[model samples]
Target: MVLTLVRYIREKGMKPGDKLPSIRTFATELGVSQSQVRSGCLRAAAMGVLKIVPRSGCYLADVTLSGIIGPFTLLFEAMYMNVQPPLIDLYELKTTLERGIAKRVAVIRTIEDLAELKRLLDAMETATEHAEMVRLDELFHEKLASSTRNPLFFSLMQVIHSMLRQSRLSYKDFVSEFPQSRKDHRALYEALRDQDALKAGDIAEQHSNRRKLLLVKNY
Candidate 1:
């Protein structure tokens, strides 16, 4: 139904801000019930493909990357809920992706990117609250990914971060290893600053492995 509606919009040459057919009209034209049409419209609206205007009508919205990924966000949440993968598995996946991201960032990170990372690191260093530290930790990694100047890497990290949040895993869980983690982060940052891609990648892998070991020992 969503596909049909999107196709209909495209077939009609509808652009953003263009009004869509009424739900009843869509239902009749698509040979679906009004309820189904409404549901499809609502899904499209949520995906940013359309906008619901209350009593006014539905209109096309400016499509964006976030809008395109919105539906997948729900799917990701559902998968995590059902599968409940081990923390080690999540750590492994994060490590694999971040190793490459670190290398790329080391080669291409700009001055501004380094400054942002430095800020996040400084904040993390002083963060006494477990929750705050975890938040800062995630932001530090996100900023590192962004420094790679690859949108796809950043998006993938965002998805992984979402999964971590859903699993309720916190940096505090690895408190016994916090000191090493801090040192690893600092070293990784220096490696990037020096444009030492290989060193950065090694540090990223070691950092991930250490966290995985901690999780295993504790949980």
Candidate 2:
């Protein structure tokens, strides 16, 4: 009921400060009991999507970035509640977004961004075990996202990171067994630093594809 109402308002392109339909009118329009409409409205308020003022009408929430992400966070939580492995489709999507971003970063990254990438690479190099390597790898990508200077991209990457955290750490053992990633990172860092977009894109795609392949082969 709550989701239905929320979806309707969203479909209408309503924004914060917009007034919702009155309870009685909304109930009649939706052909629902007034109690049901009221319940839905109340739940929407709890979900941070609407606000009800005493003696006044409901209004859309002035949602913060976290508030916007809240519903999706809950959805992902429900998807992972059983500790099942994450879907490969998500990794595929992540790789696509990352490779595209890496291409752009390679072409347009600033000197400071390259320096940060190098620092992250060095940190990854020093990490001796799976756990440390996983942490460093995440930092490496965070630096990559920062190079793009898009906060929404950074936020999405964080969500993607959380989704794959376990698989990523587990896969680090396979990554650590080979020196490929180290060599790849060096080439990748140089390519980006030199603004060699094509080389950087190729390396980024190869790196991501290799990781995906390793996951498939081992687990």
Candidate 3:
């Protein structure tokens, strides 16, 4: 049941804020009980895919960049493909989430959280290879999401980040050859350490958008 709507959304490339069919309508279309469709809708809403407005019909929620990753990943895997469009879409989503998270982190990060971020950077430095770098990178974002003290934030981030990681091979070569990105990461860490929210957010968004542009240009 949950899988059905998820697959439908992925197939349709349904953007955030699109309206979904009503429970009765969808169930009739699927030849299932309305209760089943309603239950599925509830689950999808919980997963941040759909929103049920009290006075209005159900509509797609403004899902975070991280939230759409899982479906993108599934789309990639199922089709045995990674394409430019999904990559660009995912990057845009990450840009949105990172900026928002940066604002919160600027205000909310604790000393311990900053220390942990440094520790993640240290692990990233020691990773010493692409596979290890990817692993450490995931940990870094996951840890950042935790520092925000918002579970929903982390949940969306994990999905979005995971999507990017899974499709990274599509653009890894272009990104890997850039010497400046390594330096940028360090600079980003320093900004976070200082709790410089605006700087950090700007840097994060720029970093994501740059990659998206590069990927589009080269791949």
Candidate 4:
């Protein structure tokens, strides 16, 4: 159903903020029951594909990493509550994925990508509030993933970041390592700028290990 809606949007060339057909109209057009259309729309909303506005109408959401990972955000929340192993496993998975992403990003990243990464890095270094720093940190990683030019990598990183955000408050102590993290990001960015995939991978491993240590100490 979500795929159906996404296809519909694509076929219609609807941009973000473009109004969607009313539920009844969509149902009739799609030859589905109104209930099914509503369900599909709600699911798409959960996945960040559609926005539902009360007293208004549904619209296409901006195609963003956050929106793409919205359903995973909900899934990770449930896993965090009901399953312990999955949370740990998710960290391991992210570690493996990001190392590869870092290497690929290094080889493929554009000048514009480096500029955005540097911008985020600067924001992180100067951020006085813990929350703002954390937000910038997430954005920095997201930008790195985007530099890889792999939509799957970007989407997965978005999900992992969202899941980590669920427990960020409890891990405030990790913010104490912000200075070191900033240095690591700078090194990683330089490695990427140099287009040295091997160096990028090594930096990624070091960065991931440091983060794992922080999680171990804090958790």
TM-scores vs. true structure, each candidate = 0.69, 0.80, 0.62, 0.65
Off by more than 4 A, model 2: 1-6, 22-47, 64-78, 83-85
lDDT of 1 by residue, 1-219 (tens): 777887898899998899988888888888999999999888878777889998999999998665666565554555667665567877888899899999999888899999999998888777776666667878988888877776666776777777766333444465455667788999999999999999999999999888777766665
TM-score of 2: 0.80
lDDT of 2 by residue, 1-219 (tens): 776787788899998899999999998988899999999888778888889998999999898776766665555455667876454666676678778778889878987887788888877767777777767777787778777876656666777777777776666465555468778888888888888888888888888777777776666
Clash counts per candidate, in order, are 0, 0, 1, 0
Ordered by TM-score, highest first, the candidates read 2, 1, 4, 3
The TM-score, computed over Cα atoms with residue i paired to residue i, of candidate 3 is 0.62
Candidate number with the higher lDDT (3 or 4): 4
- In terms of TM-score, the best-performing candidate is 2
Tens digit per residue, CA lDDT, model 3, 100-160: 8876887788889888888877766556566666677677777877888877667767766
Ranking by lDDT: 4, 1, 2, 3
Give me the overall lDDT of model 1: 0.80
In model 2, the Cα lDDT at residue 219 comes to: 62
lDDT of 3: 0.73
RMSD of each: 4.6, 3.2, 8.6, 7.0
* Winner on TM-score (1 vs 3): 1
- Model 4 stretches astray by more than 4 angstroms: 1-87
Runs off by more than 4 Å, candidate 1: 1-45, 49-66, 82-85, 166-173
